[model samples]
Target: MRSSEGMPFSVVTGALWLDLVYTGGEGDRSCWEALHTPTDVAAWAHSSGVVSDPSAVRIDEADLRAAHRLRETLWDMANRLADGKLPTSDAVAHLNAVAQRADPVPQLVLRSGVLELDRGRNADGAQVLSAIARDAIALLSGPHADRVKRCAATDCALLFVDTSRPGARRWCAMSRCGNRDKARTRRRFEKG
Candidate 1:
């Protein structure tokens, strides 16, 4: 799913369209994608409360191409959002523009909030992501909602809420990024 250095950065980059930057104050991320294998899809579905993991699933080259296309959609949106907060002046407009310019799958599903789609190797994977989108809207859209977020760790592109005690979490894991930062701080202190 990921290398030692980090995972792919732009997996759910479109979430930036929802103001979910991968880097910010809280240690949240904008997407929750696992590596796309048939087995991985089943595990994800089972974990996410899907009726069952689709063990009967299979993905082909066409599916891989569609996935790559989905990746591109997220990447384009993220790159645009790299400029600032959600494009308030043209949030939907920007999305629309991207939709028009980008490939077909995102264009069809994004508008209707029907993101849980099935086109590639596993129908379960698409369904899983779609479910995630719905859950995200429910969790993040209202006043009592937890703000959606992307991890600032650079390696993790996954989305989550900063549910820490103080809600000041700044990495997906303190033991991971937090420890790294602490070590760097200690190094700096020793140098001084």
Candidate 2:
């Protein structure tokens, strides 16, 4: 049980992947805007008071684009469910082509001279997208794995790692998004 648990954590190396897929960062620009109302990712600010920590955030615009690209890539890889068909060699070949065209990940370890697509920061402070095949494989099979989900809050599209106490968290922000949602209804009834 312990060893199996470690594998899921390994799949969560960076916050980038989760931020990209589960949030409105998944190329749903209109949804992103509606959720923010007058503010968008460009103008919005990270709430330092709420977060109180720096290491946990990965939702800036560049990370946003990277996450969307990865989401599409992953979607193309294996089918959406465990019972679904395994990824064909042809599918991998296609993804590799797409990864190469997008950008080369650092790719520190290549077994057979094939480009292993890792993504995110490299030691030199440059972005490299290599050597991620193993981690990606772990992500699909690990316990932390899921089909990914968007926030259910109608006006809040922020995403999260559902490492919830019961694996059921519904909002990106309870005080902000969730509270605002409740307040809007309260005002409506009072006005009527």
Candidate 3:
């Protein structure tokens, strides 16, 4: 739920895995590399709502690499679904393996006079990644599997779950790609 500028592929899709996959970007010049370092991974986990404390998470080089690998596999599967195809067996197996990792232990915390579930302070990178893997499994296998779609914007390769009531969502975000597209169309009509 962060700002689009902070994370281009924010939780508008309501899937942590999609947000992780989107950290890479659409392979365009504006692509965002949010997982460049261990610290970056920690920051992403915190900002993506996976972890409550970035400093409490210990991310090493191996964890960073693993995150990249998981992100790539998720991205591949998302692209497949977006293209009206199913994910490959190997990708599914990879996702299953990642999902098997130790998950973060949930702790009820009192925040602003409300109790909410938050990950334990000892939550590591693997645990955070496992949470994302589980989210991917749910989104891709549950009833919303068919709702997965790619943004209609030609320049944007972002994938999002169509949570609209009619399931007719096209752009990644109305303020971002959708507005740009509408403005583009308006300019074309005006010129004509």
The C-alpha local distance difference test score for the whole of candidate 2 amounts to 0.39
Measured over all alpha carbons after superposition, the RMSD of each candidate to the real structure, in angstroms, is 11.0, 14.1, 3.6
RMSD of 1: 11.0
In model 3, what lDDT does residue 40 have?
94
Compose the digit string of candidate 3's lDDT tens values, residues 82-117: 899999999999999989977778789899999987
Error of 1 at 9 (Å): 16
Give me the runs in candidate 1 sitting further than 4 Å from their true place: 1-40, 47-51, 56-84, 87-126, 143-160
Which runs in model 3 stand beyond 4 Å of their true positions?
A: 1-11, 25-31, 110-116
Give the Cα lDDT of each candidate: 0.41, 0.39, 0.82
Question: Least lDDT summed over 10 consecutive residues: which range in candidate 3?
Answer: 1-10
Better of 2 and 3 by TM-score: 3
Ordered from best to worst lDDT, the candidate numbers read 3, 1, 2
Q: What total of clashing residue pairs does each candidate reach?
A: 13, 11, 0
Per-residue alpha-carbon lDDT of candidate 1 for residues 1-192, written as tens digits (9 for 90 to 100): 233577432232223223223222211222334434445434544543442325534434454333334434444433343333442434334333433321212112343665544322234344434443343344335442443445567664544455455655566555565566788889999999
What TM-score fits each model? 0.45, 0.39, 0.84
Residues 39-85 of candidate 2 have per-residue lDDT tens digits of 22212212211121223223445544443454456544433332234
